[model samples]
Target: MSNYDELHRFLLNAANVRGELVRLEESLQPIVHSVEYPVQIQRLLSEMAAATTLLTAILKFKGEIGLQIQSKGPVNYAVINATHDYTMRGVARWDESLSVLPESFQELLDSAVLVITITPQEGERYQGVVALDKPTLAECLEEYFTQSEQLATKVTLMTDMSEPTRARAAGMLLQVLPSQAANTDVKNDTQFDHVCKLTETLTEEEMFSLPVNDILYRLYHQEEVEVYPSHPVSFACSCSKQRSADALRNVDKEELLQIIEEDGAIKMNCQYCHSEYVFDSVDVEAIHNGQFIETRKDQ
Candidate 1:
């Protein structure tokens, strides 16, 4: 569990490949426990969280990246969002009638689509979509990279739930740099394959139990590896009282007042963190009057 909740970026300079490794624990616990998720859902969500964090580390702008899976299987929807700094939050929805959910990714998310969205602070938003036809989420992501970027990529995601209460997840990404792709020779391609093969040898026990540098050294000690400074990843929800109040302005004032009269307050609950926001008649009145009323958080 050492060096947990951090994302590390490294490069095998000689191989002309860039890699990202992330191990998550404390940050993942809160997201998975936000609801009474079954073991199946918990593992899937944790993997998605790790995958999102790994993808976020490549952002060059001050914005956010969102990964969403939409399907018609037992699990209808799941989404994870992360900012450039590695702060993340996620939520999932599934059919509750089934007592036992399927353990496989494709079984749980039949007829699914994986959507990757990137929004820059000052530029147009970009989105890429690929079918979730692969057996594993990691392979689906690899497919996305190969299709969209035309770059050879490999992704591996793992979760450890032996300790039910203190679950953890980690992921690794290896991709050929586009700048190097144009000039890649047979030897360069062979080196890239060698690096990917070494990464594939990682075991769940070694990934969860060892530190970042130790894991890298064990896998790439013989290569010219350059590791960068690590960044901490945390669970951070973007929901807020003010934002909830602003959302209320969209509805007719009379409708909100009616809800207040019946339920005593207009309640808004954040699915990501399960935080409740309550707004009374007065708050509604202020909000409809174009005044942003600040309500109490987490009722």
Candidate 2:
């Protein structure tokens, strides 16, 4: 298999618990290049990239999932978007006044919020918000799942800005299937506690660089794990000049003209891919008024 892509799911029949392993190398690193970001920001982007890929992989949807962080500190907004296909791209915005990077995810995102938005193509958009907790990105994700989904889930993400500028982010999720019931006397929490105990034994190297099978063996070799087919993860963006023109067409003619005069041209930049789309005066005029008296400029 290629070193840059893939997610594997494993299920243990007797325990009603399921797990997933995802390692993103080239898949997410390309996303980090979209904007000029600090090392800390790259780490956060890696974690969110992993999270979105894992979350969307489990969904039975045709649309996209967006993980966004909005902050009141140096970082204005950091967002990663992905789909069931695992195609992804991300970008972040920060305040210009900010110069130094903070100590941790929470430090960098002081007074910020993490929001997860799931947009299914044919249905409604669902969103969940969690206040930044603990020092790490993984902890914030666990909190979001517990509060918003009421699921007993644990997530561990590791980011390395070391030589080669490589990054690896992976996650393991466990929950008692609806049919599997815990003892009423002990509450459903005990099962989750037991799972967390086992899951905590996971090591950084196993998560960051190991293949799905090896990683699962390290974590759950004692149990019966049925591994399923894997899905490839990747860095992809859906943006183009035609789409930009379509967007520009939505604005009023006067507004488009005003924007052209002010900016010298109506330019739209895709945040995900860093692609530029420039509409000169004539292009802006066509888009605004929907007028097309076809006479080629060269003609």
Q: Give all TM-scores, in the order shown.
A: 0.96, 0.87
After superposition, the stretches of candidate 1 with alpha carbons farther than 4 Å from their true spots are 183-188
Clashing pairs in 1: none
lDDT of each: 0.89, 0.73
Q: Predict model 2's lDDT versus the native.
A: 0.73
Q: Evaluated with TM-score, which candidate comes out highest? A: 1
lDDT of 1 by residue, 1-299 (tens): 56889999999999888999998999998889988899899999999999999999879999999999999999999999999989999999999999999999989998899899999988999999989999999999988887787778889999999988888999999888988665333245787889988998989889988888889999999999999989999999889999998888899999999998898988889888888988888888888888765646765
Using lDDT, give the best candidate's number.
Answer: 1
Residue 133 Cα positional deviation in candidate 1, in Å, after optimal superposition: 0.8
lDDT of 2 by residue, 1-299 (tens): 34347887778666666677677888877887666677777777888888787787668869998989988887789999998788988998876676788857767777888888888989999988878767877777767766665555667666656744666666666655555533222145565566567778878765666666777777677777788988888898888666777777777778888887898976677777776777777887776667634332110
